[model samples]
Target: MQDFLLHGILAISAIHMAHCNPDKREKYATISARHQNIALSQFSPGLTEIGENNADAYVLHAICIFLVNTYSIANPQGPITSRDVAQSFILLQGIRSILALPFAHRYIFNGPLARWLYQGSVEPAVGGNYSSKIDDLLNLTRSMAPSDDTLTCQSALEGLKHTFAAVSTPQHRKGLVWRWAVSLPQSFLELMSQNHPMALVILMYYAALVYAFERNMWYLTGWGSNVASALDKAIQEPWREWIQWPLRCIREGVDIRQVEPLKPVEGNPRTQLPTINFNLGLFKPSEPPP
Candidate 1:
């Protein structure tokens, strides 16, 4: 557990050094990887022993492991494929595995997670409450005939929306994106890994959400474009149409708010919703959305 925590800090410092201390980048990355391997060695055995004394540590370890793997794939030096992005979703499912233990409820309410769970009011979404883009995209899953797949897709979309709203205030960066992945079920994760058309469509929005607030993040830089391009190429018609806005945003490397909205129907008199202008400077780079 301590190794996991130590490796996490080192991995984070390595990312920090990419911008703050480029000369020290390789040195920290090397040491971080060595410590991470030691942490990995204990992961399997640790899984079986997640009792009261170890539950908190185990959950933290899950988060650290996911971030480390995601960082490796999202590194700008490498190419990011739809398959590579899928690995991030799979790593997130590992967190679900830990939480499914019999003592899950206790872990959330009685452990280190409580403060976060009971955290105060959440920030609103862009365009106030989910934007029309989200409404249009979600219609595909929301209207699906009820089934395991429908339920899973619904759950994943809901999670994506929750993350979309949570990150809209612009102060959010990095790890907040993990919330969407963590909320998914194993079935949805498999769909994403296989690059299913509908699942990829959902992922396009996930990419847009990342771009919306945190495209500047170290581990997430260019993720929006990489994910959008991969999915845009992989998905066929009808479903492909669902991804245009995000694809364009990624292609242009512009913020979502910077993209012009779709024009309203000729006969439609519904006024376009006004967007709130958030003060990005209100919070430091390390703070949550203001």
Candidate 2:
């Protein structure tokens, strides 16, 4: 089983590399041309086409399929192997990289430009009903996130601090959860209403990836194996349908089930923080004390 998993990963990796190597050049050209034509301020073009068409998704999907195949070959309806779990981790990593690129490299992913594009499109119309709230939620989570640029993240942190201050009351926190819980399914339905199946797929897959990462990170950090086991148990559809749904019953706010659980991950610094450079530049004396 392990041999099968290893061979499958190698084959998938080789194929994805060969496939994407040629397309990467073309993809870059297409993306750059699209950006050049778009003014980027008043209007933006979405990943609507690009996201669906990206090589990353194809590569990740291929690897995932291979992983599942390997699992089935080995277990044939029984226990999932470590290889299977590891492959899931790899898939999550790929997805995270794909998602983070939009924010990490604005020149490439261009959040503002994408949002502008969404706004300009007949699809999301400027200040449209769903656009504002969805954008707000995404932006809020992204802003609270820690990232490579200290200044950029600091600004976001400040905004979050202020936002949290304004809405920090226990009641408000509960209300926020309640509101999100109520809004989640509605948002899911809204996406469906637009015939946007990708949105639902992306949302659900992203959520699952988030849960998996949280579990593995905790396990790696020396959290008792029980948490990891609980996570594994949580992913099953039956468990997700029953226990997971009720997990959000507390306080009836923000539907904790809908949001990814944040876990404190302890690991190699290099792995965790690839983009950050810790060196501080030398300080110069101010014009001989003026």
Candidate 3:
């Protein structure tokens, strides 16, 4: 399954590269359909459970995570000295993905795990909750060992922390609180509002983990005297200050008071409504022609 996902993404990337014009490198570089679909679908409330078998969501989720992991492994940004170690870690994650697909949809989809295999089966055309789809994929990924290596562990941890942050249930809050403490302020959070707050939150979560990963890589490359001192410096005020500046500016510019809060609609029993509309131009209603 993991191999299939990797091949699919590579194939798509190759096609995009071949067909795309040289002037369109920037556009093609941003061809992250998998990530976009996951984000857009998840934020929609109407897509909670849309298919007869709910297989579409499962496959989409699986493939996206698989690609993310594959991309991270193939194009590592840090610590290339241990190529063998990194390759083994990637292989480990691949194996875990292949094995976990069976249990991934078992609880929610409630059917044979084999039904969603990558051998030849394709899902139906029903739409799905992108967030929920990725949530399941993240959960499957989380079941794997987190102590694989600094890089692998960092990647896995970041993925799990971000994806689960989407679902705002009581159980998930505990995890969020833990994650929030370590996550530094991020610029992306400024773009998010109540409607899609999870996107901002999740991005920051991974950003924080990556910050830590990069700090460690600094020590590995002998930038600092040793790993301990580098890690200590990473957690110190300098790093925190650097991240805080941009986030603080964004926070100041965005006016929260202007955005009306969600509330129950007046005189409507069935629906929870937004804040009252305050259009000033209309004359007040005069008792409706009694």
Error of 3 at 177 (Å): 34
| Top candidate (lDDT) | 1
**Residue lDDT tens for model 2, 177-228:** 1111111222333332343322322232222222322322221221112222
Models 1 onward score TM values of 0.72, 0.20, 0.23
| Candidate 1 regions with alpha-carbon error over 4 angstroms | 18-27, 100-113, 117-130, 141-151, 169-175, 252-290
Q: Please provide, for model 3 over 160-248, each residue's C-alpha lDDT reduced to its tens digit, 9 standing for 90 to 100.
A: 44433422333332223223222222222222222122332233333332322232231111211121222222343423432232122
Clashing residue pairs in all predictions, respectively, total 0, 5, 4
Candidate 2 has what TM-score?
0.20
lDDT of 2 at 208: 27
Candidate 1 C-alpha lDDT tens digits along 82-194: 66666566555565555555576466667767664333345556463236677666676677777777677777777776776665645644466667876666677677777
Show model 3 residue runs off by greater than 4 Å.
1-25, 33-52, 77-290
The per-residue C-alpha lDDT of model 2 at residue 207 equals 29
TM-score of 1: 0.72
